[model samples]
Target: MIQVTPSIAIDESELEESFVRASGPGGQHVNKVSSAVQLKFDIRRSPSLPNDVAVRLMKLAGSRLTQDGVIVIVAQAQRSQKRNREEARERLLELIRAAAVRPQTRRPTKPTKASKERRLVSKDKRASIKAGRSKPGAD
Candidate 1:
């Protein structure tokens, strides 16, 4: 089980991992060993994530989330499969933990009276400057 937070925990069975050959400067080892780890998590079916958290996860994931709502994360930075796998798990936990947070509701605020007055004053000044540019004969 992967615990993202105190309340959020995902079953290890739900995560699908795939190993593939990594590309980089590992010489013969990179050419032979399958070190890259692709971690796939289905956000739509995960019991650990709340409905709102799932929605936000989908939004935050963007193109990474498929039409079926599976979030795919690839970790290949490390040469060893174990390190790559750990990196992928860490990334998934971070993403899930971030999703678990509820964003503070933004209170809609209007411009202050002084600010509004300043804006109007600026606009008036600009308008007056433009007005002065008019030809004397054109009135």
Candidate 2:
């Protein structure tokens, strides 16, 4: 089980990883070994996540989430498959942990009177500048 947050723990079975050949630094070994890890997690179907967290996870996943609501994360930074696999798992945990936090509600506010006045004053000054640029009798 992987602990994302204090309250969220995902079973190891929930994660699926597939290996593929990576494209860097390994030279001849790179062509023969599958070092890249593709980690997939079904956020929509996960029983471990709360509904709110799941919703936020989907939003956070963005392009990473597939049509079926599976999040696909590819890790190829490391030359070893084990490191890449660990990297992918860490990324998934990080993403889930981020989603666990609730976003602060935005409180709408009106512009301050001083700010409004300053804006109007700037507009008036601009208008005057433009008016001054015109020919004296060209109205």
Candidate 3:
């Protein structure tokens, strides 16, 4: 079982792992060994995640999520299949954990008087510099 939060634990069976040949580095072994791990998790089917978290996960997954609502993660950084598999699982957990929390809403704010003045001062300085760079007699 994979623990997402203090209360949330996902079954290992929920994750589907597949091995495939990894490109780059490993030369001869790259051709012979399937070291890359592809981890697929069906967010829509999983009862482990809350509906809100699943929705956020789907949006966070972007192109990684399929039409059927399965999230596909490919891990090929490691040379060994076991390491790649672990990496894939870790990545999925990280992605899920990130999506689990709702982001704080941004409060609309106007620039402070001093900050507005500073900005205008900077703009004036820039305009003056550009004005100074004008061709002779062109103003």
Candidate 4:
């Protein structure tokens, strides 16, 4: 079981991993080895995540998410397959951890009287500078 949070623990079976060739300038060895890891997690069908969290996770996924509600994360920075696999899992865990947190709602705020005054003062100063740039006024 993969523990994401105190309340959320995902089963190993829930994750699907596939290995593919890592594309780049790595010469002949790179052509022979499939070091890249592709990690897929189905958010909509997950039993471990709450509905709200699942929704957020899908939104957070953005382009990484497929039409079927599966998140695909590719990790290929490492040359070793094991390292790439670990990186992919770490990234998924990070995403899950981020999705688990509740966002604080912003409260409506009124500008302070002092701040308002300061804004007006700055506006007046700018106006004066512009006014000074003009030619002498007609008598």
Q: Choose the strongest candidate by lDDT.
A: 2
lDDT of 2 at 133: 98
Our tally of clashes for model 4 stands at 0
How do the residues 1-139 of candidate 3 rate in per-residue lDDT, one tens digit apiece? 8998876679999999999999977989999999999999999999999999999999999999999999999999889999999999999999899888988999999999999999999999999999999999995
Model 4 Cα lDDT, one tens digit per residue, 22-103: 9865678799999999999999888889999999899889999999999999999888899999999999999999999999
lDDT of 1 by residue, 1-139 (tens): 7778999889999999999998976789998899999999999998878899999888888878889999898998898999999999998888888888999999999999999999999999999999999999997
Top-scoring candidate (TM-score):
2
- Per-model C-alpha lDDT, please? 0.91, 0.95, 0.93, 0.93
Model 1 TM-score, all chains together: 0.88
- Clash totals, every prediction: 0, 0, 0, 0
- The C-alpha stretches of model 3 lying farther than 4 A from their native spots are 106-139
- Clashing pairs in model 2? none
How large is the C-alpha RMSD of every model relative to the true structure? 1.6, 1.6, 3.8, 2.3
For model 4, the run of ten residues with the poorest summed lDDT: 130-139
C-alpha positional error of residue 92 in candidate 1 after TM-score superposition, expressed in Å: 1.2
Model 1 residue runs over 4 Å out of place are: none
> For residue 51, what is the lDDT in candidate 4?
94
Q: Estimate the lDDT of model 1.
A: 0.91
After superposition, the stretches of candidate 4 with alpha carbons farther than 4 Å from their true spots are 24-29
In the predicted model 1, the residue pairs found to clash are: none
